[model samples]
Target: MAAGTATTAPTPEPAGRRLLRGKSWLATVPLLLFFLIGFGLPAVAIVTGAFTVSSDAETGAGSFTTANVTDSVQGAYWTALLSSIKLSALTALIGTAVGVPIAQAVLTSRFRMLREAVLTASGVLANFGGLPLAFAFVATLGNAGELTKLFHLTDHGWSLYSFTGLTVAYLYFLVPLMVLTITPALEGLRVQWREAAQNNRATGLQYWRHVALPILFPSLLGGFVLLFGSAFAAYATAAAMVGATVPLISRQIADALSGNVLVGQGNLALALSLDMIIVAVLVMAVYLPLQRRSARWLS
Candidate 1:
């Protein structure tokens, strides 16, 4: 350095900015702890337990083995898993198809109260499932139900305990969930885009096909993935309604845990849980990118 030249010190960060940064990080501590305790630890335990077999039931000691995971993908377990996947996919597809139009209608409606009512109802209904929902359906559609007797539906071969009935029950909640999910995306559609299409001599159908649908596709697909995960993980409703008759993976997991048919099968339950986690991870893998894409357009 030249002797005549003077050096300057770097400017320090403002105390308020430093405090804000510290507070922001402090706010995340509870959330981080929640994920660590509620998800991370349980996930680790499930993975470890899935790969080990109990050598002594009394002591809960186990040795490492891959048989639990191998068995989870075979026979009854595999069948149950497939059934779950099919059910979830079917419900999600139907829910999306039915929901998108309803959401659009709700969005375009002139009445503020109507929109508020539907959205509020949807928020409640989307979270409404499990035993109460099952019971309500059973009372309304069961063999001895009033509707069944009045319309002779049972004689016409409609059974609430069947797979078809389960699909119907799933839709009751899924459709509302889809509505709640896709309404914002529908609302995000700028009027200028439609006007621009109209200025180019495009019909409504052509405009939707060329522009609107493409823009909304990510939100639509993300909603489908969300509904699929919801249906896939649902257990209480299926358990209450159809019990073991449906052979769903959730039911299978419960059976394994309880040793309903097999003794000392807790490890098998962990394997099934791991399977569920993998499916959830895959669903999230697909959902997150779609969500990011949707946010780019919508936001």
Candidate 2:
């Protein structure tokens, strides 16, 4: 019998492609480490701190109790929770209003130069949070601020320590995030889709309603949820804007820790517990809808 030629099965992928696939694990390592260090540690600390009660002045015991959580849920706690929900909802609404237009303007336009500038500004503005950022706004619009003085609106016209002022400061951050999130969704609107809609004689509003809005709504809602959650927990910015006029959850938490509250360090534990509960609920509420929307968009 003649010898049969040897046969070999083809490789699943080329060697070069396999090499890149194998290296994908490297990309995931940093993200895993980040979640472990940044998120994991703080979560553990908070849980431990909240449950374990204090014994001596500065020390806490290993035991657990529900008293802290119960005590922290009354009076000022209830008020702060309501204020947080209201403020966050308002911020999300405002962010959506301002961001949608800016995103639409940028994505639909052919101005490359302007797009870069707008994107850069959006990145900076989106990250403008915390105390320093708050102070920057204060310096520009506060009673003694430069622009306030120049515009002659500081003395008898406007007050920056009011809820309205806090809303504005929150908007400064929320708008940028909305722009960043929604711009991508807008850009993803395959040109063919728009052209096809136009070819069918659809008006701008009609096109948006039937095509654009559905596509962009997921991103818009996701961005709004993120900004809402951030605004809810926002400590430094609102604190600077309201000072003593408006009481926010973060400020109360601070008070608990720094002796501003009469309950001493117990209040700190209680406040932390409240913070944990509020954050957990907010996260779940926002995440569920966002996750659903994201899955819908993907499918």
Best by TM-score: 1
lDDT of 2 at 89: 87
Taking all chains together, the TM-score of candidate 1 against the true structure is: 0.92
Cα lDDT for residue 240, model 2? 63
TM-score of 2: 0.81
lDDT of 2 at 96: 93
lDDT (0-100) at residue 222 of candidate 2? Answer: 77
Each prediction's RMSD over C-alphas, in Å, is: 4.1, 4.2
For model 2, which pairs clash? Answer: none
Off by over 4 Å in 1: 1-13
Query: For residues 1-299, could you state the per-residue lDDT of candidate 1 as single tens digits?
Result: 98899999999999999999878878889999999999999999999999998888799888999999999999999999999999999999999999999999999999999999999999999999999999999999988888888899988999999899999999999999999999989989999999999999999999999899988999999899999999999999999999977889999988888989898888999999999999888877877887788788778
| Tens-digit lDDT string for candidate 2 (1-299) | 45897777886878898899889899999999999999788677776666656666655345676556665667886577667778888988999988999888987679898888888999998888988878888899888889889988866668778878888889988898888887776766777887999999999899999987876666777777778877877887877667667766667677777777666565355555557466657656755776576556544
